[model samples]
Structures are given as structure tokens and as C-alpha cells.
Target: MSVLYHAVRTPVRWAFRLLTDLRVEGLHHVPSGGPFLLLPNHQSILDPLLIQSICPRKIHSMTKSTQFTQPAFRVVLAGLGAFPVRRYRVDPQTVRVLLRLLDEGQGVCVYPEGERSWDGALQPFRRGTLRVALRAGVPIIPVGISGTYDLMPRWLKRPRPGAPVSLRFGEPMCLGAIRDRSTRDRRLPEFERQLVREISRLASVPISRETRERLDAGSASPSGEGGS
Candidate 1:
């Protein structure tokens, strides 16, 4: 890890540990050193800080392109292992950066849900996010994060003090060759379910029927997954 990364993670982890009743499990599932994709469900704004800071490995994650508008923030985010992705558009440069980082044996994390859920339920993943996993030559780790939504949901601007939170990492999932995008689309619901089941179990969150229905709808529709 870079000195800058260490410098930031230490204090963030410290503050979180002090302020929140945090529980972390399945550390063994995280590769001690290697290129692996980390798929975490987005919960709170604190999710990234919680996952990356508590994680033993250095994790490079995607931040919104707008977050990098400020020059100082851009430098800070880059040092903290973040790159900007234009969420609403196809950004090839983001994919190049992701692939390049993985090629260098760095751990990369992307929230499968494009953004944090409003009601603590797992939201539908944006098209192109999962497709990245298909292209990467690495194992994918599904992470379940609970309680951050309770700490601070979309309705609240500030976190509640002394809320409990948990992070659970599951075993690796490796996908074989997908015949084509159409074939992949046919199998998309299963793939989404795989993540939902693993993450929800790991975090002890119940999979909602509505969430299942959304994935079902997604399977029949043509969509894209990229980290391409």
C-alpha cells in the first residue's frame, strides 16, 4: 500500500471503530495479495470508507466523475485508489484504468448496485457493471454490508451515533466462458441472484421478493456490464 493510502485508512478506520459497533467477517476470503474483483452492495455513503478501510488489502474503487471536479479532491482520491467513472455514460477510460489496475495485481471494488439503496434494499445494478467481471481474469468476491443504511439512510443527511454495522466477505466466484452477450443476458437474472444470495446471506440481510422480481425483469431485457 502507498504511504498516502495507509495514512488515510488508519484514521478513517479508527474513527469508525470508535463511533460504530462494527463487525467484520470472512477476512480469509480476501486474497492476501493478488488481482481480484470485489463486488459490494452499496448501502450508505460510508460504505466505501467502511469496506476499504476495514479491508486488509488495498482496494481501488470507482467514484463518480463529478466527485473529481475539484483539483485537490482528485489528487486525494487518486492517492486513495479511486478513479472517476461517468455513471450515466459509457466511459472507456474508466474500463482501461480498471483493467490496468487489475493487470498490476491491485484489488478493485465496484458496488454492483450503481448507487446506494434508499430503503436498505439491494437496488438494481446499472447495466455494464457486472459485465466487467466477465472480462477480468480473477476471482470475484461478493461482500455483504449491513447497518450503514441504518446509520445513515438517504433520508438523513448525517449518521446516527452508535449504530451497528457489519461487513461479510464470501468465497470466490469464477465464471466460465459466456457464449455471447445474448446468452449472457439470458443468464443475467441468475447471475444477479447469485450475488444477492451470497451477499445477503453473508450480511444476514433478507432477500426481498421485490428485489427478486427486478432481477427477473432484468434477465429478459438486454443490458450491458462493463468494468469492459
Candidate 2:
């Protein structure tokens, strides 16, 4: 973490603490050291910042390439170690940058949804996002953020103060070559389901106990375990 990044984060963190009743759970699940991929469900634009505020370590997440066009924010975001990604398409440079960051032992946050959900429902993981984690060979920590959507949905101009929000981190998933299957293509669907299931469980949303249990059992399989 850079001095500038900490300096800036301090005030922003304080503001969030005051504005929202924020609580973090399962923080110990986050590894204290080494490169790890953070997969969070995207609910609002505030998702990344809210996650960063409570995290013990600094996070370097991929921002849309267009966000860097602003002259001022570019410098600030750069200091925070954010990299640019061209959304809705595969950009090799962005892939290389993410892989390199992971190899260098820096924490990186990527929303598997690729974009914030409009209906406040969990979205599917982008296939590319899963592939990157697998290629990087790092533990993936699934983050479930609740209540931010009501506080500031896409149509809102500003956040509503005093709303409650919670961030829950789940156990690290390590999806090694499943059952000696040498091909990633075969494992992709199961991998995606496992990631989504973890996020849903962590979110604690309303779902039948039987359904939840089934998803849990499906995802917990050691052979197809998903931390990719």
C-alpha cells in the first residue's frame, strides 16, 4: 500500500463508518499474506469501496477502462494500485496485468458479475473471471455484500445515509484439476455454479433450507471444489 493510498482511505473509511451501519463477518477467512483473488457479488457502484473499507489488507481491483479517462481520478486510482479493464470483451493486456499482479503476491478484487445487478439479485460469474483465477493459481475468497443495493441503486444520485450494510467472507476455494480432468473447458460449468453458490450462502438471502443444502453439497465436492 502506498502512503497516498492510506492517506486517502482514512477519511473515506471514516465517512463510511459514520454514514452506514456497516458490519463485517468472517474476516479471518481472508489470508494475511500472499496473492489471493477476491470474488464479490456486485450490487452497487459502492461495492468495491465498501469491501475495501473493512478489509485488513489493501485491494487492487480492476476498474472499467473508461473510469481512467478523468485526469484527476486517474492519479488517485493509480496510487491505489487499480488497473483498467475493457469490460464486455476480452482484453489480453488486462489479463496479463491481473495475472502478473497475482503472481507478484498482491490482492486483487474482481466482481464475477462483471457489472452491478439492476434487480439486486446475484448474477452469474463471467467465464473470463473464473479462467483468470484458475490461470493465476491462487485461492479465491468469495465476498457477499448485503444491503448496499437499497442504499444506492443504479438510478440513485447519492447514497442514502444510515442504511445498514454487511460484508461476509467465505472460506477459500481451491479448485485444483478436478478428478484429473486435464481440460478447463469441462470444469467451467461446475466451477461457475460452485462460486455462485458460495456467494449466495454467504449473502444469507431467503432460500429454502433444502435448496440451500443441495447447493452447498454440490459445491463442497472435493473433486470439483471451487476456489478458482
Candidate 3:
């Protein structure tokens, strides 16, 4: 499945690169072996596609369960190595499936923010991601994406031509450093906070401390929470 995904992705990546002046940094940080998590800041719907394009490893992506309601869409998602995840609900079944994929040494891509940002700003990391990462005992690689929202914002039907996009792959974070059975619940929040901070540091555009605080506060609420 991964082999097929790579074959189909090559040309698509080139096309995106041609259309958008896409740039990537810190590719060397991705581990060559073992299970790992690619946790990126969600700016637009295109963010996931962009990450899949540049990553050398084939990533198992999680999509909204609603998208799978359509048979055709479900087939396409399955072919692309994506699985359905219920939004705003902690699905243990989905977590177990992801853990199995990790155990097989496959890479998984997750948006720690849980959803795309309406304003192209970084949002708070969701605890669900932290739960999976810690449970699977996989390293979390922080990724930062910039300018995708301008290209294809929620209000737009199609992407604007010639928009700039940048992706930065931060250093891989060791799960061992964050693991603590005694304070597992508390650790997720702190881990997510640190993850967002790392992503913000790598973004092409700078984010203000005040804005980060606002995003974190907003994410604490149930509303506007996105699927995996």
C-alpha cells in the first residue's frame, strides 16, 4: 500500500511544488526506522497533502469519519492509506488501529491542533494525539506549515494560484522523556503545549505570545474542535 501511495504521490508533489513555491527544512530529523508520529500545525485543508508530499516516509493519515460516508470517498481514502476518525469523540478503536500501524513501523500523521485554523494561526494541541503517541511509545516529530490558509481558506472553493507555502520539520521528540504513568493525564497538556511552541518556532511567520495564549484558550473549549 505504501509503495503504491509513493508512486501516486510523486507527480502530485511536483505539481504542488510547481504551483506553490513550497520549501521544506529539517528533513534530516525524520528517523530512518521505528514507529514515529508526524504532528503538524493545521492551517488549512491542504496542510495534510503538503506534508504527505514532502515526507519520504509513507504516512498513515486519519481523516474525518464523515468523509467516509460516501463510498467513493472511502475507497479513495483507503487507497491513500487514510483511516476514519470520529471528531470530538475519543475512539479507542481508532487508537488501537493506529497503534497497530505504529507497531508495524509505519509513520502516522496527526494534526495536534485537531482541525484547520480559520485564521491560519497555530491552535492548541489536542490531548487525543498525545494519548496515542504516549500509548504507542512513538517519537513525535513537530511540523510547522505556513501560507496554506491564504492559498485555500475556508471561504474559497479552490486554491489561489501562485501562493507561497513553507514546511518545517522540527527535531523529533522522544516519548520516553514525556512518559509518566503517575501523571499521564497532566503530561498530555504540557506535552501538547511544548509541541505547539516548537511548531511556532519553526513557522516562516512569527506568532505572538498573546495570540498563542488565545489559541490555547480557544482550543480548551469543545466547539470548533476538528477531527484527526
lDDT of each: 0.81, 0.76, 0.74
- Candidate 2 lDDT over 1-228, as tens digits, reads 789878867777787788889888989988899888889888788887887767788899888888799989899888877888887566788878887888798889998777777777776556667766666678889989888887898778899988888899999987652323345545655776777778887875533354345445553222332221
User: How well does candidate 1 score on lDDT at residue 31?
Assistant: 95
Task: Count the clashes in each prediction.
Answer: 4, 1, 0
* Candidate 1 residue pairs that clash: 128-224, 128-225, 128-226, 131-225
Tens-digit lDDT track of model 1 for 56-81:
99999988888899999999999989
lDDT of 3 by residue, 1-228 (tens): 466677778887997889998888998888888888888877777776787778887878877788799899788778788888897576766777787898899889987767777676666566666666765677888888888878898668889968888889999888663345445555555666677678888875455454478556644332221234
Ranking by TM-score: 1, 3, 2
Q: List the residue pairs that clash in candidate 3.
A: none
Better of 1 and 3 by TM-score: 1
Q: Candidate 1 at residue 67, lDDT?
A: 80
Please identify which of the two predictions, 1 or 3, would achieve the higher lDDT against the true structure: 1
TM-score of 2: 0.85
